[model samples]
Target: MTFQYSRSFAHQLDEQDTLKEFRQWFHFPTNAVGEDQLYFCGNSLGLQPRTAKQALDAELEDWAKHGVEGHFHGKNPWFHYHKFLTQHSAEIVGAREHEVVVMNQLTVNLHLLMVSFYRPTASRYKIIMEAGAFPSDMYAIESQVKFHGFEYDKAVIELKPRDGEHTLRNADILDAIEQHKDELALVFFSGVQYYTGQLFNIKQITEKAHSVGAIAGFDLAHAAGMLTYNCTIGM
Candidate 1:
């Protein structure tokens, strides 16, 4: 059935939604007059959940009562801190529990992933990326190539749209990967382009990279919680 495009239709759908109760769990900002505001910037910073405060308070109580023992004795132990997130994170990203881990911020994770996957050989030394990537990615890749004794310009292949175009075409991306296949050691792209908000063809991109013997990696800072796609990292 086609979804009707009206406020009443939206409200009807919301009323029918099984997960509607979850919406009340999130904390929304309100104006001075106490009207709830519509927020569209979750892409940048997600709003704090109402339950988060209670969870945090419980942790504080544990710390006050147990001190360092809280690491082992708390409701969610700090000793295996990352374990708390693994299964849920895996489900969100559509991966196995063993295939995912939560760590530092986006840049730190990018550097860590690149450290293992960005190994460069004499012939296969180039990295293919979007023309205007998030700043952290551009910096990390540049520094990585330079650390391996290759000049930035020669070692990094950035794919840009044709003149008068704002976003990349899939054909152009595939062609670029094929054209640079011999030199490409890795194909790194944003899961969703931050500037253009473009969701890439992840599966085809990975296949192309593998066909040409290049490892594929993705920066999912913007993609996670925004949409679902199958992604293989460090392969």
Candidate 2:
């Protein structure tokens, strides 16, 4: 689609959107005049879905009736709740269902994953990631390396764009991974850079890390829902 810089153009594009009607499924905040406010804060937290209250109420009623047994007795058992979400969540992230687990929130899950993947040893322990990753990522990586007896400054290789550039180039990322291949334990990156809105090539990054004998992990908070998995992948 050609770019246009007018509200009418935006409206026309919206009109043509196949999923435009899905807007009614969410509860948008209204202004003082009771007009629906223009919203762009979804990256932080999404607008509540229209059926959210009903869903929550059902779970509340189930809890009231089943008590602690709700884990195994409710319509949606709490014990296996993540299993029910696996397929849908996998599709959103373009991953296999078995590879998905819809459990804890981002930071919690990231730390849990680090426990399994960020195994630092005498030789290979460094992590290469974008310089301006989300604060959660920075803190999580920092804490993980520190916990494993590595200095944050020395263990983490933060990649930034070249001078006067806005976003990082794929070549630079791969080169960094190669440059530190011997010391690289993890190539952690954000699927979509939060600040710049630059989408990284996940498949290439994953393959590059694997090629360098490093584990690759991506924080896909902003990518899921906002981005589409249109590229072909090799089996």
Candidate 3:
């Protein structure tokens, strides 16, 4: 099981991977010269699925045939389109069907969810999050705090790695929550940090946040299909 730095070793591992065949499901990017490019930027946009063309064509055809009636009648009714994705989406995130709702853009959904959960009293108005969070999340938290007449620095606790370190330690995260137990109103974080590719310990973070009477929330933008784990990971 020794790891080697060679093309043959890479091929060997790929040959043994159980998920090897899944790669063909998407069309990888190709350079202008017709060479396939390596892509790892799933944080923002994922590779287009090969079936996307056929799928879009089907929907377009339905729209042309049914017109406005497509909302009520079609291969997949637009009125109940979200329902069609509910079960599978719920299963992927390890949440009950009732707890999951697929709607709105990510930033919009994030802002709405924060508004509902982040009720900040003067006494308990601090939010804890990773320092270099996704830009949308950072802006969302900033606006939420500002909307409530609180300054970003005073209201939000941006957790940073120690000197010379690249990622956060579990103890540091838990300790921060404990330290701000009294003032902590919300523990908001990205499910998988886009910059560092660090998949956090969600369960432990939630437990710590709850032990101190604070609520924990996650924006699983990159984690829904990108995160790879043997079992379910949830709050």
Candidate 4:
């Protein structure tokens, strides 16, 4: 089913939206000529919340007032600041607080996960991923394979859409797993394909990988915040 949009339609939507009042909580950018630009880049970087300034100012005030003791005594203590962010983050990813941590940037965390999960064995040491994964993920996986003393070409297997197709079929992915069952060690794919916006059937893929005695994981950068679902369904 296709949908159409126009200024009038958008206005109607804005009028009916329950969260319309929350629009006042942002600072949308204006052009040099002082006109508000129609910003459409939230997929890259979200607009700053209007509350951010007040939040930061409060933190600054706490720091100035408490100095070294602010780590434990501030209104929002710096010592456990990241912990405060974790509950919401866990809810976003559909994970337990213990399973999630806000640490390094995306690729850095990917590399760290690879170190723990990419334990290649002698007979089954191959890692499968999407053909056009984000460059950072590709680089991280390549480096991980090399770090574990495997050649890039031999260690990494990239699944591509079949000829004349733009998106991968679930059957194709299952076939790849079946074909390489003996050699496959890990099956990792993006939860959502960044380019095509394809949300992979994560539960199905994970089940297939497990059936083939392979470990499965996902990069959830694109899937989070836009959709409501449970990650626990796959497991």
What is every candidate's alpha-carbon RMSD to the true fold?
2.5, 2.5, 2.0, 2.6
Q: Please identify which of the two predictions, 1 or 4, would achieve the higher lDDT against the true structure.
A: 1
Model 1 ranges off by over 4 Å = 1-19, 230-235
lDDT of 1 by residue, 1-235 (tens): 5789899998898899999887788899998999888878877777889989999999999999899999999787888988889999988888889988888887888888888988999999999899999987899999899989999999998989899998889988889899999999999998899888988888888899989999898887788777866555334
Itemize residue pairs with steric clashes in candidate 1: none
Model 3, global lDDT:
0.87
TM-score of candidate 2 against the unseen true structure: 0.91
Per-residue lDDT of candidate 3, residues 126-231 (tens digit): 9999999998889999999999999999999999999999999989999999999999999987778889888888878988898999999887877887655554
Model 4 lDDT per residue over 1-235, tens place: 2345788777787798998898788889999999877878776688899999999999999999999899989799998887988999888878888877788798888887777777898899998889999989899889888888999899888999989999999898988989999999899998889888898988888988999999898888888767777555212
TM-score (C-alpha, index-matched) for candidate 3: 0.92
Flag the better candidate by lDDT, 2 or 3.
2
The digit string of per-residue lDDT tens for model 2 on 1-235 reads 8889999999999999999999999999999999999989887778999999999998999999999999999789889898998988878877787777887788998899899988999799999999989998899999999999999999999999999999999999999999999999999988888889999998888899999999999888888867887642212
Using Cα atoms with residue i matched to residue i, what is each candidate's TM-score against the true structure? 0.87, 0.91, 0.92, 0.88
Model 3, clash count?
0
Candidate numbers, best TM-score first, in rank order: 3, 2, 4, 1
Q: List the residue pairs that clash in candidate 2.
A: none
Pairs with backbone N, CA or C atoms under 3 Å apart (clashes), candidate 3: none
